[model samples]
Target: MKTYLPQIERRILVRPNQTFGILNYDMDNAYPQRMLELVAQSPTAKDCWNKRAKFIAGNGFEEQTLGKQVINSKGLTMAKLLKAIATDKALFSGFGIHVNYNANFKISSVNYVKFEDIRMGDTDSPETAGKFALYSDWGRKTWKNIMRNKITFLDSYNPDEQIIKEQVITAGGWKNYKGQLYYFNPEVDDYPLIEADSVWEDFETEAGIKIFNNREVTTGFLPSTMLFMQSRREEADNSTDIGSGINTPSQLEKDLGTFQGAKSAQKIIVIEYEDESAKPEFQPYAIQNNDKLFESTERSVEARIIKGFSVPKELINAEKASGLSNGSEKKEAIREFNDNTSPDRMELAEVLEELFSHYCSNINPTNNWKIIPVPANVADDVIGVKAGAAINQLLQSSVPTESKIATLMYAYGFKQAEAEAMCTP
Candidate 1:
């Protein structure tokens, strides 16, 4: 069989600003790229993007922390580890895992490999089985590439440990090994190796442009006002023998220097002239008004960016959401969190289920075992309304108090004895 290699150059050529799958010039890149090169990057955009990514990632593990029940398999204990890997990939766009096994065929441990040191190869050729190379540095020096059906244990920190490390090469198939290493590239179609790109990159650029424009406005027009001076007489004359008069150039230079000095010191300027008929008037030029427009533009752009991430505006305390009450805002936030955030968590859970199915089967042979994300809680208002409606219906119906007490005991986790005692009263 012919060994197939992917078109590595094509993948490498994709820029950070371009869309994931398409091979065309990114119009979004033109402005943000220029802003990055010209202005100080907007830390606000960067911070918001980071916070949003982390928020999304954390929402995946709702009500559960590390050491909690994420995955319930005998040999494969990878619930917390999988969550961490998924979070890292969401933040950095890629993540890798190194699967370790003991002398027996069962899996032993699963460790997260740094994304910076792992390079994916031959991605276009799925038939040949893509390669994963782990290196100590970004330069690709002193690296080990794990080819198809082979596992290479890398110890870059200690030279002595490196000498003792064993490289397990399995030729039969991936199924022969107790565990295998895997690299997850979430944005591989959009961005390749040697480039940084994320969902927030465009937002960051838009923010950068706003910041730059504001800076320009402040520096150019905010500090000082333009001064306009008009004089009734153009020429000054003195009674000299041969048209010898006051040097207008020297006098004008002196006046300009005095004006500048007065302006800098914030002092009142008083001009005196020898000619009584030479009348002069001073007027301050009006500053241009674009502050409101700039503010509106910024808000619009920010709104679009927040929408792009499918995040609720209330979560970010957006100003445009002033009409919503605190209670309504809280309800909206919870609804968005449950409806939007849970799907991503479900997709991640599904991926982990497929990857760790082998060990999952060992744990529960009779039934299919899979990883499941804990569901997000519903809004308190909705829950309260439902409970109220149910209580109203029960009161209207002819259900016995004893039956209601028993139902309450079962539904609310109340002790049956206590419920019965309350009913007796």
Candidate 2:
């Protein structure tokens, strides 16, 4: 068992203000009584001693407390001695130190003694150490008092309240539960059982799983896979202030879209322009890392990776798609432009191209340059020439060719405009 000693220390200080006055007189006499009062307030001091008696030679709590052990075993009375040191300030009021108890009793070496013993005066004692520990000791005691009755686990054995309550004391003590006072049954009405500790029900496929509702579910248990449940408690901490970061509106605007699974992590692209009046006005890019949201709008077609790697784990081509061809981000953009609402083919096509073209405008051409939305062969009824042929011939136009290729790349992945350069060449 881990134990803690009262937080106590030993030290010697001589004050020039009251070196040999009434202060010295009080230090030598008035401290022991005050030390007695502090120990008398320890309700659990005796209980702690009973829990660990065989180790020391003494009876009752005081004899076992570090101070008393220091006294009875070593014949030292630092508690009274500490009182002498604090004689001038009533209870050592001006010093930035205090002592207190831990809710969980401790058994360790805690002492408060000065540096040197006076040859012309007298020796130090545990009474003085006790005086110093008194500082934090009292505060710790009160805190422990407030935190004493928390519930850690209640049989919650059967998801049934009746069984949990009947077994509360059996499962041990209640030391960390709070909020709603009931657990409901699994089958039938799900209404809470009055006064029952908790109810067992098969919430997830496992049998006899114990669970709770109403408050936060922070703790859980598994009993031979036969019975399972969780326990929770209200929070008791605070956040610290220490940073200079601030969030802006533009950063959050792109999280408003859906995603495709098989990928994890979402990326939104925002473009900052010294001049937003360019002909294209603005470009949009989005990529999502979700596996459960991929599907077709109306039909499907055979597609292939014409030139680059597959979707990256994260999207990094948004600025390029939005018309900022810096090319440093060479990794294949992991964004997808799935049109679920089945918008008009031309409309969806336009949207997809705008999204990708804006993204590619930022890819690193010499090193990381790439293309995506792998060209697809839709073997269905066509508008004019074969679907594949029409796009092939179209992309075979100019260096900064028609918008179809850009739109197509935007809709799927981003590839460089080297295709347009190829067509014109």
Candidate 3:
């Protein structure tokens, strides 16, 4: 732990669910052990890599049969990808140096806890820092090593609150609240965070830089670094144990099993394309230059956006600033208003009818490109919106700039011709 993490800085996301998870090396600072050879391979990766292995593997997972995918750069399991490069020199040297993707932010960061903390959800009791007990055919060897030697399996519990307060996540049996930390309990979902008592130790932070403000120099982790640190806690319970030896650990990218990773979140869906048309590179027949697209880390990407046609000069941070560490009681924290308003999960029939009727009225059939309320790209906030609520809101907002206007409308809730008309100028 003494060696400074080259291009690595931890990611901390503060979302409505108050979620936080790891966002491994940003592409610019990204270097892969095995895929360094493939660097010249994929230009679409003019973006980044999986940094930590959770690269997915499945039959035709990234298959060409899926259609309209960009250059089919073969994919791999995050674990296999990592295992191959962990020993490669090119991987070490290029620790964090790749071309920038969004270029929205000046600096980027990576996390180390994925290497330091392994977690387990206490089925018996999901309260306090519940420790792991041996419960598998993997033998006692793996258990013994992990307990004392292997990096501690942290629960990956709430860190934002701790980050905000700069206080110990757990003090005795207590979890922290507004001015205090509280303890764990069975009935409470909001309180009693399951935290390991001892804070991670020997974890060192050193300043190293590949480039800074157009020049390379030592610096600190900055930017709105918030990621969904789901930490495979969900995937662990669903995983099928296959490995017998401790060293020959199960690869993070098992052929078809769910693992602890970002895509595991049901809310975060992926719509991966095996062909170029489905890819971000080649514009589809329906797309125009003004349209915008966002990529999800999941195997298949989900469309949850509508970017403004003309770039809005002002960017706003409408995110709730109630603070992540606010230890509110379970009863009080339940969202009273937003009980169930999902935009992502709406029915298309209703949407089509609405749009179809609109077409019969206001649309100009002569031109499809000149229209109001055209689909815009998805924004981060809408991603958190419930499936149905997000969809309806987007159509009504009709913000324009989405790559797929008809499909999102039909799938969620919009009229076909009117929805098309919505896209026409």
Candidate 4:
């Protein structure tokens, strides 16, 4: 048996406006860069902000930790603290990783730092320039930097405070820190530390707009309208006019109060009019259509948010697809699981892999382990139905053996070459 590695063109520069023009084709001409700049300038989406924050904060870090229990330098457990950091990262656009070490110079604990607390300096300087700097205060107003993986405090520290209080300088990266402090940000090219834009930003804006519409529909500020009274009397009509129509503001108020009281008590009231000829009518206000539209729009927005998170709509109690039979609904659920839920779980798995790897390297140097997410299982009935249909099609169709073999191979998750080999007579 021989092992073969696929030949890949690893250095294919897909980005526009490369410095080496010889290797670059000016097709789009920096359009990608302009688009990125636009995205960076876009405002944070407030409508979906809380929902996204809660999702990331609560569920993102839940049940994701591996190996030994992680406790931060401040004695706070990573399981709880990571949720806060994740929430902040989703709300803001970035976060910081602080490395802590024990007395033996080995890693003890790692913690998360808020985006606002840490600052980067001399980002343009190369790795060899020795001028790159990272600063953080952690809210105690004592700023410090990491030197050679060890936290080094600045000279401006109060000597009295340092002596009186055991000043612990916890920086972004410790002197012995070897693993990466940043994750999920590959766009920070040529810079020591640059925060990447949040992935949920666009969705947030859309969701916010929908929410605003829903709020307006639900709590609309409708203006009060006056009921007009038409008189048939001539210019000399000074006769005491007591009619069914409300003649004054006081009378209108009294009538309204009486009506409200009766309605609240679930009672019926009959008013005797002095003048039977005078008519009382109301200016019509219809809200049934508007209410229905708002409800539909809100449902659509909720569906979009669920789709954006790549979760099953059923999980959120969203309306199921209309006009689908029971069997079709089951099939759709399986498809949703395979397409969205499984992929999202897999991405989280990769993040956990990196996280565990970083922790293991520091705490137990020899412990090299990785965690894999369990894939969502599709229902056996759905699988069997689809497989039976495919087999029936293959038997009845006039397609060649190679085509049938290729189709069967695809259904069974075999490679193209392997399928062709199996089909060869």
lDDT of 2 by residue, 1-425 (tens): 99988965322222221221111212232232233233233222222212112111111122123222232134434333223222211212111111111122211112222211111111143222111111122223335431222311111112234443433334343333211111112222111111101111111111111122111122111111221112112111122224634433222132322221123124343534344342123233444522222222101110111111122212222333322222212222211211211122223223223222322132222221111221112211232234345456556655355575575366323365643453454
**Candidate 1 residue lDDT tens string, 1-425:** 89987855332243321112212113332322232332225444444444444544553332233324334333334445655665555444456666544444333455666655553333354321234444443331334432322323332211122222332343333334433456556564443321123334455656666765766654443334554444434433312336554444536545545545323444445666666555354456665555677677667766665555455666665323322133466566755654555555555555545444433234333333233332234233454456556645654566798787766566544477755664563
TM-scores for every candidate against the unseen true structure:
0.45, 0.14, 0.15, 0.39
- Clashing residue pairs in candidate 4 are 148-175, 149-174, 149-175, 149-176, 150-174, 150-175
The TM-score, computed over Cα atoms with residue i paired to residue i, of candidate 2 is 0.14
Off by over 4 Å in 3: 1-109, 112-117, 123-159, 162-425
Worst 10 residues of 2 by lDDT: 298-307
User: Over all chains combined, what TM-score does candidate 1 have?
Assistant: 0.45
The lDDT for every candidate, in the order shown, is 0.45, 0.24, 0.24, 0.41
In every candidate, how many clashes are there?
2, 68, 77, 6
Could you list the CA RMSD of all candidates, in the order they appear? 17.3, 35.8, 30.3, 17.5
Compose the digit string of candidate 3's lDDT tens values, residues 63-171: 2322121211343232232233222211121111111111122111111111112222233444413332111211233353222233222232222333323323342
What overall lDDT, based on C-alpha atoms, would model 2 receive against the true structure? Answer: 0.24
| TM-score order of candidates, top first | 1, 4, 3, 2
Candidate 2 segments exceeding 4 Å error: 1-146, 150-152, 156-412, 421-425
lDDT of 4 by residue, 1-425 (tens): 99999997432233322222111111332222332333334322232343344434433332444333555546666455545554444433444554433433333456665444333322233321211123333222343432333322121112232321232332333443332233222235221111222233444444555565555544333323455444544312434357844343444445545554222444454544447566545575554555576567555655555554444454344223221122455455545544433333344345544454534254434443222222224223454566557666665688898777767566555566755665565
